[model samples]
Target chain A: MNPNGQNAETRDGCAAKLDVCGLDLYYADFQALKNIDFRLARHEVAALIGPSGCGKSTFIRVLNRMNDLIPSCRVSGKVMLDGEDIYGAMDVTELRSRVGMVFQKPNPFAMSVFDNVAYGKRMRGLRDKRQLAEVVEVSLTKAALWDEVKDRLKKSALSLSGGQQQRLCIARSIAMQPEIILMDEPTSALDPIATGRIEELIGELKKDYSIIIVTHAMHQASRVSDRTAFFLLGELIEFGDTREVFTNPVDKRTEDYISGRFG
Target chain B: MKKRVFLDGLLYGIMALSLCGVIAVLGYILVYIFRQAAGSLSFGFIFRSAREGGILPMVVTTLYVVVVSIAISLPVGIGTAVFLTEYSGNSSLVRILRVAIETLAGIPSIIYGLFGLLMFCRFLGFGQSIIAGAFTLSIMILPVIIRTTEEALKSVPVSFREGSLSLGTTKSQTIFHVVLPSALGGIVTSAILAIGRVVGESAPVLLTVGLSRNIPRTVFESGRTLTIHLYYLTNEAVNPDDFGIAFATAGTLVMVVVAINTLTKILTRKFKNSQGDAS
Candidate 1:
């Protein structure tokens, strides 16, 4: 974190902002996202909500070029981080380091909890054992998993319950000190108790890092996000302040989606 | 009541018969080899040619073939399997590659021997030598290794890969660090099977390595394997003593392969246990 509480600037002021304009994504002939335009302010929490196959997860993956790993997947237009074109003049390794992601299913690496949290930091060449230990503790604490795992730091991450695994993944991502965290249905695999913990963790995370979460659960969007973007069939139907979008949606699709009429 | 009794009897009888057939055949072979080789079962028979001291060179030659073939085939086979199961796009090209690999695997050993003799021995300037034999063996076992490895790699749940990749790691890292470890036991089994194939081959070794009694110090040198030694012992036994030598060699080869297979089973179980505990 910067001492001034502001992100460092690149050539474009967009580093302080994440910009996606006229973005389209595809898998072979199948269009996944169509002309999706959205932005996330620095240190803000934004949620994307929609029915299954509505392209919410696709949008979050595009932010960090995770979609690029899929063969036959193609993208057009731009996604800028802090005003800088993250797709341009950036190595994928560096881009991924700056923009972290957590999956819908909690995927703690097959290693121990400490190693899982330390993985990202090690990837970025943080080899000092002392520094790695400190980072792992801080990250786990931030993810609200420190107390439960503090004693069994060396235990296999797979031994943890579902919720603990998810939190460990979050800690692993944050240990890299990424500027943005993109989550694709992060809590869908957890039970309500675990879901609540993840929601609480996301709430605290927004104070330091910008987050873009894709969710199918409307209540989760309302409960956690500051801004919500509602998508339908590859298009962004509506995006605005979460409360306004949910209570008084401007688009009928968004209204129908939130009110449970039909999605 | 009558129908149920008949059906139950038929089903149990068929299964028992199948099991009996397998065990009987194996037991017969073991007894025959042991009984036939009794006269030749000595330290001298294991250490030098029957004409000289024992069959040490043949044992060494078999080891050379197994090691070289495994070294050559393991990486290419496992890598191809990984590509097919993990990174392949669901496209016509991948489908074609898979079919081609299957077809290649189905090709007979004799045909593989012919191809090896023509290509590695004659065309590639390797000559009739252990190197040619190794190349032939490598090609012969490629399909077995590849198909087994592909199955192993595919069996690892997608959740494992997703778990690794979602943590900001790349696809390659996930494969190496997670998927491969999970499938290592299966891959090792494939290797053991390949080793068995290479060790048992006679026709390919005959065409490529030739039936020289001299011990090969390098892959490029001509040599005869245990199976080939067994064959000549049967065919050119000029004396009754040589027949005893052939049975002894056969028994020794069987024991070696059985030992290796047993070791593979033990190692695979150990690996599976460790991974289960680790995860």
Candidate 2:
């Protein structure tokens, strides 16, 4: 059992791998996320669930500073990775490498399967052919794709099925050995079978990495996450153990959302 | 409804007629040029220098100008495009640069020739040489290259850029590795189009690189290109012999242009196939 009195099945007693304190984000004059405080423990899967425009995706993007790409987007408040304030102390590149992201669309680069998996390592200047091959093999295996694609590492990544493409994207991120993986609706574009495969992969992945997934499907959040944070109109309506949030939400809005009364 | 149908039929007929007109004009020109040049075009006419025999000097000059101009313009044009698309934040500076490029594109080639005469031939002391002509042609084609490359770069999806950046790759790295390769087909098409424009120009070549008959050994020496050779031969033709040389030069220029267009088509197809495989 964890010494911190948290449920041993859900969370370890280790310090939060990511901590966001009083965070607010804006795109131009419009506020996107307001006064959000969140913590993600090491090796736990925390799912962010909300309607399309409730700032769940925005909140996750802030974790990796991907919002910095927008010219008018601004953030106020601290996003702490490990112990360092990412905006204040960490280089953006360093922050991104440590916190990799898999996007909603399966965005495998226009290259061979092997090259796509090895791209991050190559960017970090790994030149040894053997090391790249090993990383590719291991990452693809972790993504549950190595067996299917092992024979065709030289083939184009685009030729893969949509599910396989998404997994390939996951492998690409994993190859970087990031501490956390932020997935923005990674299975939204896939079939139910593909979604099941990805959900299973996530269950396996949480043992090694802290994962924060933004999901539109309530069932997915309940099925896959240890914890759930629900948002409505840029506000965190409620956050707690996933089972409790679904079965007995403290906030009426959270209950309404999960019950399909209203978004 | 009957009136609308009639109008649609009328528009379709007009469009088909316009398409036929364009094809007919192109076909007529090709047939006429080939018929005129068939008797005069020979191995000796292409191989020997103008003073000794035919348009060898002019062919060599045209090649030098095309190579030098493309070499000078391509890097500068692509760099400007990258800066505008990747670095600029939709600022007024970018707006002004775009306007300037548009203006350059709109200016007549003759004005560029005059500008070359004053700036390169006289002021730069490159007087009536292949280098002066090349410099002028580079300026003439810079806008074409810049505009086409910018469009190509812009066509690369935003998701690709974001994905690369999220992987901790730098902006320049994303552009070079992901964006540029995807846009390669468009870039090559634009470059070949620019080469076609350079080859067909006459006024600019005449003013910047005077009608010298000798084959140039260096860029500083004066030489004549195929277009200028055709122009002078036709202008001075008071006999059948002079007319035959003019027709031969015209045929050669048409062949070069046709070759360039064919190369562009083949390359674009190859690139599209490769991109299909990758994506």
Candidate 3:
């Protein structure tokens, strides 16, 4: 046991897979994310729950430097992966490959199912058809979509149902074999049954890959996350075990939010 | 409410009338040209040289000019559009470039003919050749290609770009692999429109490529395009007995334009269908 009355083996067994320290982000003159300190251990699922426009989405984009595509966006803090500052030392492409992202909308490329799954590998210069096929099958299996789409690998990805398309997106990210996956409201566009399947998939995924999910549903946060962080007005109001954050929040704002008092 | 309903009906009727007016004008011209030229429509008139009872040399020259001009303009125009839409920052320079492009699109083709005559024919000593005419037509059509291609590229959803970038692909790769393929239908439509303009142009071809009756053997050889042939037949009254030939040439030109327009519609429809199936 550690002096903080926590199990040292659980707390420090593995170093943080991704850490954001004193992170501040802005879009032109509008401050989107205030100073933030967050960490995710390997094989753990961290859920960021907040009301709309509270910077949860922006914070996740900061992880992969996806915000770099926005001309007016800027960041002034250290985003560390394996203790090395991603912004300062890591190449953007390398960082993105290491930290894959799934957007709110299921954005399967206008391509065949096989091509969609094989795109990342192709981008990384893999040309062997056998290798690409192996990666695609493995990824789709991991995303739990292989059984549904195995017969129609050559069909257009957009032909699939909405939920299936979302899983294909997950398979696409998984094919890259990233250490972390950032999902921004990935299930918001899904039906309840589809959302349940994704939640179950997230449970299975946390055994191998760290996940940082930003969701609007409070119940979803409590159901899927090991650790939950509450954001309010671009601030991290509380960060702790999911049970404690939901049942006994330290901040009055966090308490009011979890109990559905106000956003 | 009754007044508003009446106004709405009036506006709709006016729009319908305007559409009918456009279709009537187009249909009337087609009928007139077909009726006048039907008597002279013969295989020999189509295949024989201009010196013979045909306008085949002029047809060949027009084709040459269209091919060479499109070859020159397609790559450069599409490149400019890609740079403008994807790479160009929203700086003052970009603003100036956009304004300049719009201004170029509005310039008269006669001015382009003069410039081509001075630059390609006299100064460069490629005097009154098919190549000079091709270069002039390329410059005249460049703005059309660029503007249309830029619009097409812009219509590609930003989400597609984001999806590609998130997969760690470079911007150039994303553009070449995804954006360009998606915009190809529009780009081809633009090229066909430019070709239509090139085929119909008379003043510019007349100034750059002289109204010679013989088929051009090389880029540097003088030739006469169909439009220039029509102009000569009309103005010089080359043979009062061969008025049917003039009408036949006019009919062929109109047919070519109509063919190109039909091709544009077909290509766009095919692309839209494929895109629909994909997404």
The candidate maximizing DockQ is: 2
Score chain A of each prediction against the true chain A by TM-score and list the results: 0.93, 0.96, 0.95
Question: How many clashes in each structure?
Answer: 8, 0, 0
Taking all chains together, each candidate's TM-score versus the true structure is: 0.83, 0.92, 0.91
Model 1 stretches astray by more than 4 angstroms: A1-16, A27-31, A112-114, A125-130, A146-156, B1-28, B31-53, B82-97, B122-126, B156-174, B236-247, B261-279
Give a tens-digit lDDT track for model 1, residues B1-279: 999999999999999999999999999989998888899877777887536868888988888888888899999999888888887767899889889988998888999999999999999999999889999999999999999998898888877776566555677877887889878878988998899899998998899999878778899998989999888779988887777778889988987788778887888777654544412
lDDT of 1 at A116: 81
Kindly report which residue pairs in candidate 3 clash with one another. none
What tens-digit string does per-residue lDDT give for candidate 1 at A1-263? 43133322311344446888899999999999999988777777889988899998888888888787688899999888766787899777778878888888887766678878887666556789888899999999999999999988877888999999999989988988988999989998999999999998898998888999998888999999888999999999998878889889999888887889987
The CAPRI-style docking tier of model 2 reads: acceptable
Q: Output the lDDT of residue B125, model 3.
A: 94
Clashing pairs in 1: A14-A82, A14-A83, A15-A82, A15-A83, A16-A82, B48-B54, B48-B55, B49-B54
Docking class of 3: acceptable
Rank ordering of all candidates by DockQ, starting from the highest? 2, 3, 1
Off by over 4 Å in 3: A1-10, B1-17, B237-241, B258-279
The better-scoring model by DockQ among 1 and 2 is 2
Cα-based RMSD of the predictions, in order? 4.7, 3.0, 3.5
lDDT of residue A25 for candidate 1: 92
Please state the i-RMS of candidate 1.
3.6
